[model samples]
Target: MSRRQSELEGRLDDMLSRIAMETQEIKELEQQLTDGQILANEVLQRDLEGIISGLQEYLRGLRDQARRSQQQVDSLQAENQSLQLHLEDSQRHCRQLEDRARTHTQDMSVQQEELSVLRTEAHALRDRQVESSRQQEELEVELQQLREELARQVTLGQLERGALLAAVDKEKQSTEIRECQLQATIDTLQDEKSSLQQITLRLQAQLDQTRTQYTETRDHLDQTRLQLDRFTAAMLDPQEVQSGPDDLDEDKYRYHYYNFIFQQDLAPAQTARSTKTWFDVHAITVLDWPANSPDLNPTENLWGILKRKMRGTRPNNKEELTASIKEIWASITPRQCHVASRQ
Candidate 1:
């Protein structure tokens, strides 16, 4: 019985040992699984963090891209608005140009028609000129023949009168005293007649010369009239004539310079001796006077200023004086004219 009890105890111990070994192997396997699970959880958490970070970066990039796109869109919109405004302006300009072109074309057409009419009138005037030239040639030839005939008549009369005087001088010698008295009277009459003939000839020549001068002046006047007529015709249209108040004012000012002679006189307050000494000082004269005078006088006033400026300086010659005058004139201004005219 003691041996059987011991054998049972050993069997129980062997079974307990086998069970502990299996339990230990099970525990090791569970620990390994737990470790694997923890490792997997850690890996998953890291991956999730990585994904979140990537998503955040992508979102940030998207936001920046969106901002850039919005800015680009805004710039494009502004550009579009600018282009639209330019297009409208260009369209308005084109319309204005088109209107001006139409008006210009119409004006050109009218001008062409007027030019055709003027050409026809010119042709007619040329024909009339040819006819008038033929008539003038005939008149000139007739005038030359008349002058020649008058000259021949005067020569023939002189020859006949000389022969008669020679015959009378021989016959009247016998009739002594009576003949001498008659001869003296005849001689006095012949001298007086000769003088009268010379006076007549001179008067006729003067009359012919006067007639010729008159004809030339008349022809010149006619030519001037014709030129004025043509000019008036050519510049008849109000639209074509660009004259304005400014042009008229310019012409008025220009006319003032045509006969403007500047003179200087002595001042009223000076004594005769002193006045003579300073006759040209601080004195100005305008020689021309008209109903409508331009309100400017610096051209003449500057001469007085120039004289004042040259009071101490003596010019050597006309050349130096002219150069000095040019310098002084160049220094004058329109404002000076305005002030001078007011004074």
Candidate 2:
């Protein structure tokens, strides 16, 4: 009995020691589980799996030992009533070991759940890395295309600028040429303007001379017309009255003092200063004269004869009228002039 008791004590002590070691290992694993998955290599994963499997195996062995101890307690109770107390103590110790084994199993299960969650998170990280890599490739392609398009735009702009510069140069040359031509034209036109001014000055001088000549000619014609009017008046009217003595004989041809009688109508109304036509300013007697002297005047009688002949004949134009006047004046008889002259 002492030997068996000593052996039982030794076994309990060893199981307790093993259980404490297993708990310490589980606490270490729990602490390492969260951070270990990020940098853990395949070798570390293998070592962890070996450790977990070994703990599971150790727990299984503990359960089997507990079941064997229960069997021993049951057999001892049936075979020896005196060993029942000792066997009961051994059974209690076995139950405690079984409870410890169950606790270890529960702790192992929790650690496995934590490892599984860590693996899922690692898979999610790998998927994000692949998606990010694909996005980076797409961005690089878009950036390359934009750079090429920008290069093409820059080249096209350079070509257009060159063309515009060339066009500007051509326009500048054309403008300079046109300006020179316009300046030459202006100078030529100024010369022509000076020539025209000289010609206009000559024409103005000619026009002034013509106006002067026309004024002199018009004055000469006016003087000639005045002389003709004076001659006609002098011929139609006697300037003086000639009368013989108071009782002068009709048959006598000579008289002592002769008086000249003038006609009233053809007498000069204004004063005249001339040697040959000197006369008094006394007016002629108008009350004793006839209203018309057409019968007494020879020139009046000639005009009557001419007008009588031409009155019946209507001349169509000025030339015909002038010809008719010439014919009537030539046909005048000497008897008509003698009949018109009376005392």
Candidate 3:
């Protein structure tokens, strides 16, 4: 009985020890699983944070793009309105010019008709003078024959002689009166010719002036049309306006500069004085700019930066140039914008 009891106690200790070993193994496995799960959760959290940050940045970019689109639309609408008004005015002026041209043309036609009539009448008067002179020569020869006949027939009655002389005198007086009337007609025709020539010259001058005005108006209208066409094309596809790298380069530089100028309305009074003719021609309003300002121009600095950025890239086409420019612009940091603003 004592031997059996001791054997039973030893078996229980062995079983207990085996159970403790199994329990220790299970704890170790649970600790490894927990550690793996924690590590996975941390990695997932980091990935989600990155995704959220990227989405937020994309959303901001979209908002900014939308804002810029709206501003461009507003500016285009305003410019279109102004162009419409200018077109209407131009059309109205064209109509007035047409009316004046028509008036001048009609006046010229009337003057031409008067001139033609005067020329015909002057020619008729010259023909009549030639016929009158021939008739006068014939009458003078007949009078001389009558005087010789009278001298040869002196034995005849004195009354017959007296009658012949009286008839000759009467005929001479009639010829003199007719000559004076013809001379008066010729002088009158000469006066009309001179007046008509003066009128013709004056009308020609007016016609030339009208032609010049019409040409100028047409040119102005053509310029306006071209401007509207360019604006429409730009509205449809902004890239269409960029013909080449040089154009894009200049335009990009001007874009930043003009934006800065417009945002602060910089140098308003100075611009009015410097570009008076240009402003007056365009009829643009000059807003109030800060006074007595230093010329802190930022475009030159931006140009230098842009040139440096574009040093390595040589675009072969307009599209390539445009893409390169866009890429460079996107790469420009906020610090650059801040620096430009400060300047």
The Cα local distance difference test for each model comes to 0.69, 0.70, 0.72
Runs in model 2 deviating more than 4 A are: 1-151, 240-343
Which pairs of residues collide in model 3?
Answer: none
Model 2: lDDT of residue 247: 32
Instruction: Provide backbone clash counts, one per model.
Output: 0, 9, 0
Tens digits of lDDT, candidate 3, 17-73: 665575566556556677777577557556755765675566566556656666877
RMSD in angstroms, all models?
39.6, 54.0, 48.8
TM-score of predicted structure 2: 0.28
Estimate TM-scores for all models.
0.24, 0.28, 0.23
In model 1, which runs have C-alpha deviations exceeding 4 angstroms? Answer: 1-62, 89-93, 142-343
State the lDDT at 248 in candidate 1: 31
* Full candidate order by TM-score, most accurate first: 2, 1, 3
Return whichever of 1 and 2 wins on lDDT: 2
